[model samples]
Target: MYDVSPVQLLIIAAAGLITSVIGGVAGYGTGALMPLVLVPIVGAEPVVPIIALSAIFNNVSRATLFRDLVDWRRVRLVILPALPTCALGAWGYTLLDGRGALVVIGSMLVLSVPLRRTLKGRGVTLGNGALATSAAGWGVLVGGTSGAGIILISLLMAAGLEGAAVIATDAAVSTVMGVLKFGVFGVSGVITAQVVAVGLLMGVIAVPGAWLAKRLTERLPLRVHTAILDAVVITGGAAMLFRAATF
Candidate 1:
């Protein structure tokens, strides 16, 4: 059911190990990094499903690792709006061509960095209603694309969730999103045996990476963490945009 060569599988395993660690620390990396590897192997059509499937394990690990810090209130706020919109977004994703979705994902990623910084500098924040409204919009984007977790990270940061709180809350919300996306994909016949098998394999291999990140999160300075997250988001976003443009 899967087309990946043994060599490609090896490469994916390595990427999975690395990106999971990054996800553990930054609250979002697996989705951003996996597509860079998966798109060429699985093609664009399956990349989102694959990411969504694997993400169930990835976020589960992170949420568990950071369970002590997760803000259940924020999780509730984000999930309430994100759930219904995500279903719509998944349906909408079936309508978009590969390049169209890539363009949307890339644009959102690139724009999010500056948007976040500007908001922080001015002390701007969203009330619950505004947050729910924004979550509705993000639900659509995330449902359709890989690497869209940065959107949630940005939203959480804007809402005054700093450092560990941001990662923990993002993880909780992403866990639910992962489950929702999986259901949508499964019902749509997008989740094949190969996808599930590969996703689970990568997920198990990624556990150590999350463990390492969990240890580091406590030691890393807040500004350093923020900078790393921003840099990764921008670089990943730029890569997506470049790929989309070339495609």
Candidate 2:
């Protein structure tokens, strides 16, 4: 039971499925949205580790579905340079107390709105050297955070990937980083039987989400959905910061 009430477990499962569908349509959701539920139910420290494990399922599915579109060259460019700092960042996350964890996750969630917009609109292209260097910085941020995958998607696009290529590349990159995060948390002794159980349940429920999202993508005006989601994220993030300050 992972020490959770059945309702809490249900909430986690619902979050996984809802966020998965949101992610399938939007290219980023689980990382941004999952923390809103997980933080309250499990406390702040476990949020990143739980999401790190659950995300492996989400990203790996996207990678497989879009495997043909993945740019191996860009994957290589981003992954290698990112590994070291990713580890450093993951390790740093382990050191945060509950309040610190809440602030970090909340602040990132709040800023992700403008940061994602700015990166998406960033018309400047990157050369290989610059892309790799930028990825190193991305590694640090992503390693420690849940919602930073949007940054990776933007990076891929700015590096000349378009359409399916960007999604495919981001999924592949995130799969690897997700594994790296799990390993770092595992080594740091954050992994537990409860973590594995909850993460698996969430993943299994989410596995079919992309297919469901395909049906909704056409009817759902992405602009409207995105705007609404942005509002929710900002509100949820600010709430977390408030909780952190008062806790």
lDDT of 1 by residue, 25-99 (tens): 777767876776776776666777777888888888888988999989988999998999898888777676778
lDDT string for model 2 (42-109, tens) is 88888888888888898888778778988999999999999999999999999999999999899888
| Candidate 1 TM-score, true structure as reference | 0.87
Best by lDDT: 2
- Runs in model 1 lying further than 4 Å from the true structure: 220-246
Please give me the total number of clashing residue pairs in predicted model 1.
Answer: 0
Poorest stretch of ten by lDDT in candidate 1: 100-109
In terms of lDDT, model 1 sits at: 0.80
Task: Score each candidate by Cα lDDT.
Answer: 0.80, 0.85
